[model samples]
Target: MTKDTRKTEYGNESISSLKGADRVRLRPGVIFGSDGLDGCQHSFFEILSNSIDEAREGHGNVIEVTRFTDHSIMVQDWGRGLPVDYNTKEERYNWELVYCELYAGGKYQNNSGENYEYSLGLNGLGACATQYSSEYFDVTVFRDGYKYRLHFEKGENIGGLSKEKCKYEQTSTIQKWKPDIQVFTDISIPLEYFQTVLKKQAVVNAGLRFILKDEESGETFVYCYENGIVDYIKEITREDGFTEIQFYETSTKGRDREDKPEYKVKMQIAFCFNNHTNLLEYYHNSSFLEYGGAPDKAVKNALVYEIDKCIKNRGKYNKDEAKITFADIEDSLILVVNSFSTVTSYENQTKKSITNRFIQEAMTDFLKQQLEIYFIENKIESDKIVEQILVNKRSRETAEKTRINIKKKLSGSVDISNRVKKFVDCRTKDLLKREIYI
Candidate 1:
């Protein structure tokens, strides 16, 4: 065999590392999970999450989001402005850390409640990652009775941090950035995404006001839920639910394992049985849990157990009937769960779900106890809930049976004697001669 001319030398120089902005700009998918519109949308969420965390800490009550005609997005919060000055311990300017460095943030020590007890921007990568992925980013912070400003382009700081004295009453932080088209294939985030996200934040945060301004459409909208998920449920059911809404909330401390450090978790649940509408939403640390790993499992287990027990005790089930499933309860149930924990185990950077064993156990036990007490205190409401769930279960079973029978009949060999109406059979086996009629 001839010597291989194509064989290239493999040496230490072959290994390389991405630094600073290149880490996110070169591989946007690695950080944001996509290089498409989804990633672009997530970048927007990162900035909004920071604002939400600040507001949750009682630093602010209102957050304003603006979508300019040029597609640049701005998030303004009336909170204690971000720290951008020099850090004595880190020996670096916070502006550089927050706007340029990845994995440098204030939330890393959240478990100790040093900065925040519960927060949405737990990864410490949102601010920097978004900045790196943006074409141009600008930050204006009002704190310490002064104004601080920073600007960046393509992940590189410009003119450094600017400080000036200003007569401002409330401390605030305003960020404006345009998602880079080079980094993200598409950055045209729709207006509906902002509306939906702001609404969700308002629902989970309670009493927090979100103002959305759309420059393209010249429209402004506000979203706030004074009673959080409970008010949201009322809005969805419109007083037409078969049973009255029930709200339960509790706080507890626990750990995933014996050796793990203990942490606090706060859980809120609001639900009602409605024949005409149904919804199930789970949120952890103000981030919407689309997959709902822990909370979903807990909700399913507790609701099914309590409802099934109620059915058996009330003689609502037929003899030898199968137990009720979560689907049965879910069919007529409209529930919203908002939970917060000092330590959260997000499955990934996208934060669509959480997998905290302690949170799951705490929620399941609390929900079971609250449901048991509710059933005992409100007999009529519990009866209505049980009856509706049974009706849904029966309806679903009947539908499944009908579907199976139809599928079986359709799968059978074609018989001219029992031909379907208006369906004519072709006489020839030739491919070109076969025809179908409507």
Candidate 2:
């Protein structure tokens, strides 16, 4: 096979063999699910996820994504970069293969540990897929106290894993990729989506700093949260659980993995009830797992059972106004449950779901016991929390009923907007002409 004139690697493969046009032309919709804001959003998210992985490993926090006028993009992270080591025999590439080949990555291999105990990029397709979809790709890695660089042009690595011997008196290397305009279709990424991505990342992972700069627009947004979930709780509930629980934190093993060489569970849970009717539960990891799972469910159940038992046995218990369900307490109470386990994977290579169901169950039981003790010991403070939960339960119920009523009222309406008739009769007919709301 004839190699492309660019820096060719030792592989007996040709870029022409990959069928770039044939693969993308017929199935363009696959890489980018749709041709709209969603597809545009995915373009940036794919890169952001890479940065988030670095944050997960405690390697680096600050990630910068810059935009260009012609739609080229650059994403740089100060985290531990993609590893590179020649396969002593194949004389091929290491990290370079990761960029070009399908399902080749440390995250999915189950070989990495520590913060990477779980892999976010499941199927190991994240790198290869993104590279395949883009016009070309470039990667600069700073690892093992050395800096190396590789460039892939048109879904082919021009040169495989070229170490920059003369460059980088600094440790960080640069990665620049020009996205395939044919797939993206005349779009510069929206700033709002980028902000949302960075904000979510900062909230889930503490001490992570992300910066997004639009080179042409001369705009840069920075997100960094040092206090982690505590700050996140404060942002949502406007109440700090720690201010009342003070020096108390209850923890349990949230995930167990014998295969992992070393494993640990660091979980801190605190919650305070407020007068608001809504329930807000914040369960997060360094950069992923916002959705609650068995672990979080287990924890909530324990708290509810403990409160109920306390009220039943002891007559002077708090929450006499309303019987609080675990559901009830979740509302109006700001709960921050964070677990950083030395072992990441509960079971799957994706590491999105936790496998150890018993961990959540164990935590639930432990928290229930301790919550009972804390309540008995601190009557005034604990009772205040109890009363707050009752208030939330009542309000949450009312809110749900109100929503049902509203939906019923709008049953016959064609538009869900508040002013259906007025909206329909607006001066010039132009939802089509309406400014880009989407």
Q: Model 2: how far is 54 from its true place, Å? A: 3.6
lDDT of 1 at 68: 94
Q: After superposition, which runs of candidate 1 have C-alpha atoms over 4 Å from their true positions?
A: 1-7, 415-438
Candidate 1 per-residue C-alpha lDDT over 140-228 given as tens digits, one digit per residue, 9 for 90 to 100: 99999889999999999999989999989899999999999999999999999999999999999999999999999999999999999
TM-scores for every predicted model: 0.92, 0.68
> How many clashes in candidate 1?
0
In candidate 2, what residue range of length 10 has the lowest lDDT sum? Answer: 239-248
Off by over 4 Å in 2: 1-43, 55-58, 69-72, 89-91, 108-123, 142-148, 159-162, 178-188, 237-264, 276-285, 314-323, 342-355, 394-438
Tens digits of per-residue lDDT for model 2, 144-250: 66668777766766756666544443344356777676666645666676787688678667788888887767988888878766675566656434225232344
| Per-residue lDDT value at 283 in model 2 | 39
What's the lDDT for all of these models? 0.93, 0.61
Candidate 1 overall lDDT versus native: 0.93
